[model samples]
Target: MKSTISLLLAAVTSLVVGGIVVTTPAPASAASLTEVANFGDNPGGMRMHVYAPDSRPANPAIVVAMHGCGGSGPGFYSGSEFASAADRHGFVVIYPSAQQEAGFGKCFDTWSAAAKRRGGGSDPVSITSMVTYVQQRYGGDPNRVYATGSSSGGMMTNHLLALYPDVFKAGAAFMGVPFDCFANAADYPPGSSRCTGGGGANRTPQQWGDSVRQVYPGYTGPRPRVQLWHGTNDTLVPYALLQEAIEQWTDVFGLSQTPTSTDTPQTGWNRRRYADSSGTTRVEAYSVQGAGHSLPSAGMAARAVAFFGLDGTGTTTTTTTTTTTQPGTGACKVTSTVNAWNSGLTESITITNTGGTAVNGWALVFPLPSGQSITSGWNATYSPSSGQVTARDATYNAAIPPNGSIDIGFQASHDGTTAKPSSFTLNGLLCATT
Candidate 1:
């Protein structure tokens, strides 16, 4: 059914960009747009646009793509290229329209205490209603549902993951703050230092994670896999928030404070993965170097689809170059750098293939100082045994071409003493520390 709620448009005269508000031309993909008026007591009177792919699978996957402040549902369809992805992947994509009535220029009220709670506010309830509506009316598989968004939309993605974990299998948040990062909108209203700053405000990892747990109190079901992306140069949403978001998700997934694997799948795009005991990655984070307050044009949607396991044909391919190397020696060289302050420490290890041949698979071995321990790591599978830490390449990063390097990072707890590893080994060969 197509229903228009024109009453709310008067309040949404402009769109939010970073801290600036500007008028955007109305979206043009009106032909395929279907407006949903009443979604289960939508107290906020929010509308939604559902885009059906040219052809859908027998059991279509559903993706809810939220727009940033000042963006409409139809606008998200064009801006995010979500409809193209849906058409290619045989999934149904829903764009939920946030109204100015909800505050912050049509942005979902992610900062509000009521919005943070499960089954408490209009935004979450209305979004949940959309999921139910999609599943019943559009043949969307409840198990394969996922969500992704930008800016305010991204914040709402975090809100949905926390409040309605059971409804979404996974979610990807781009340039968004952590769940309940602020108690109320007034505390850190959009575009303020507290909202745009990338760092945490004295909140411990446990505290940040607890913010999410509190939203769905006493509801223990399968938690959704989370993927976070942040541009390092984003003035609107600081890059430091990426670390805070990572900490929050690590706590939520009950993973260690450190990442299990960290690596650069591509130049300028760094990723860290946190895995469960069964070796399944439950949380992933990306740092988009040099990007400022913008969405990733190519990899975001593809990666999210692959992460959700909704990519058609049930398989995804990663291209990597490989070379033969003898154990303990060959073309691989390792370099390690550590940053420690007080009791907190972080380390980055770079492995470079120095030989003319590409190195197919590799591992880095090193010993930590007596008082330092590995809490978490990323890009490589990290395990510590007998005071020594060993990191192996993840599937996507296993192949390194000649002169190509892969870097991994980890967080650790120290005893207020500085301890640096003197030497490193790749495939059991000693490497010179730079």
Candidate 2:
């Protein structure tokens, strides 16, 4: 029986949107919106929106898209920078909404009593629900699904990192302080204390980011790569505080040395790259020269995904010569890139066939962000249409002749959206649909 199910997962954000360089195109494949779970009735009315590419019965990537202050599920995914790519590439995206006004408007109550209220705050459960929902209903890659958000949503991403480290392999956040430790009333801006309940409360980004790091120490569970983005001009969540938060990340992430910044290929951007003392988990921070507290909504999403070790470092520059006429076949493989460093929207995939049967005419597809556009490709002829991207063997040799295999690669721009496919399929075969 063929079935399509909807899933839900959630997180929160307190930061604001920096600036939109451009509105991204929606994904190429069929885009569907379903509420897999709800928080208070699921008030906060938190729900998850899953974007699936046009591939059939395959395990595609899964990306978690969270919005900034006053933003919820629809608010985040409707015109999201990653929308276009999700449709065109066959990927899955989950949007988690925040609470309502009396609760604290659209932003995740980063400062409200219900925000992370342990057994009370439905936010944590909401995110878990999203993951379960997607897995059961959508067949997403449990390991590949990731979390990303702007400001409070960004804060929510960090919260997921602390709470559900195993649920995701990576995260990309912009203008957000650490989840477990962001400043409160006293630490908030001059008149900001009124908004944060006058400080005397709980932990800030500093505490949260640090505590989560320790709880999921670099040596334990599956430590996911973390990418942070912040603008120098953010008045709401000052750069200095975020800088301190970066330092703490380096420490808890178990980095031996301190992390600093340097300029990148793009102007108005600097990177704070860190390698754990053990050189295991690599962490990076992209600082926008004079950005506000908003999500690089269109900028950092894709770029950060790349920095987390997902993007292609250049196609299989490793193809072997046409050895003997002997037969040899292999499973297909994919290598993709996410901007991770630019717009933070990055991803790359290299799909290679490792079996002995040179399969004839096969289709490969996965999910991507809406804002990122595919600039270049190689090996086989490729086309991204209908919110679903397809690559095929050269007409000269469409078949993966006996003992032959081919590798295909691609690059996607994330713009703050998680570009992980819940599942993927090759040549109509369910290589990984769930």
Candidate 3:
């Protein structure tokens, strides 16, 4: 792994963006989303939008999905897959919009003194009020409540987990800083704030943990589990903050600075889990190799729900079983072509839907040969990086018309052997290779 100093140096030499940037704008609000009025106190004056899936359980889980700077609750609701997951798995989603009345430009209040203190007035208090309303009105499962966000929203994820541990079970913060890292800096803009500019990276683990401890002094209740994600190449918020967050969270959980287990769960993703005494993971982190500030990447929302244990199975399955496959006749055909040189190769796979009807929302499963692993991909998202890989369609190319085809491929590295997948399956139906 590259050192934080080296990454900062590289960021300094490259073009950098201002503010906590959201690469994609939130789409229009989903039809299911309804704005709530008089739900709670108006200390922060933030807007609240809630999504209740058509088939929610009697006691459904509640997920707080926050947006980055310049992003709104409705936009986050429509752009993110959280509500879609809620539709599949019974849950209610709370989308809270930050007010620009405080001059934050739709960014959550992570810097204000009131925002950092437990039960103090501001966005945090307003959010808690919203959660309370959900629990009373929607019969939300308090034990299963979770929080997740990107950029500025990510910062609030940390703040919420820190100040309201009793309220939130677990949280996932993408490109966020340590709790209270922006404390008492109400005068500075987010882009130029000392903490946002990477000046708070030198704190010790205990010092960082103390920041969270100060939020609820003398209260020794169970701390919320946290999952931090940041790209190593992120420039808006320095990559070093991810480590600082790990240090703070691991210290708060009383785990060692060293991770209990570390591995690459997917291509370009390096994950570390800090388990408690009972072997339950308390803090987890993911560093995306070579990625920039653009995050909450494809499929991350599902992963966050899985982390929250709201996925019923408490885990994510990347492949499906093919029960409808015939030995010689299948509904799909695939052709894989590879261009290789030395130890690297780029392989393109074209999938043709041979069935009489259109194929929608597909996952193509194939196994990479030994010693080959994917580094990056396009037009699809590949999981596990190597071995048996499942390529899920990107939103734009998710459906294939009758007799139509879609192209997807990836770059990989090998041990001087360039081999293609032996076979392919589309949504569990075996596909003949051409």
**Top-TM-score structure, candidate number:** 3
Residue-level lDDT of model 1, residues 314-359, one tens digit each, is 3222222222221222345667777988887898888887867776
Across 196-260, the per-residue lDDT of candidate 3 in tens digits comes to 67665579999999988987888888888888999998867889889999999999999989777
412, model 1: CA deviation in Å? 48
Clash numbers, per candidate: 12, 145, 0
RMSD (Å) per prediction: 15.9, 13.7, 9.3
Best by lDDT: 3
Q: Rank the candidates by lDDT, best first.
A: 3, 1, 2
By TM-score rank, best first, the candidates go 3, 1, 2
| Cα lDDT listed for each candidate | 0.70, 0.53, 0.76
Per-residue CA lDDT of candidate 2, range 1-434, in tens? Answer: 01110110111223333223223334333546666644233434565666665662477667788777556666566535555445434567777766543222455545444454443445766666667777776687787777787776777776676666777777887766665453432333212443223333233435535566554445476566777888887765556656655655665565634453233523445665665434343566777765565456333444654444333321111122221221111144444444456454334454555555656555554434355556556666555522335555566646665545455555555456556542334543323111
> How many pairs of residues collide in model 2?
145
**Which stretches of model 1 miss by more than 4 angstroms?**
1-31, 101-104, 193-200, 313-434
Candidate 1: 10-residue stretch with minimal lDDT: 18-27
Error of 1 at 124 (Å): 1.2
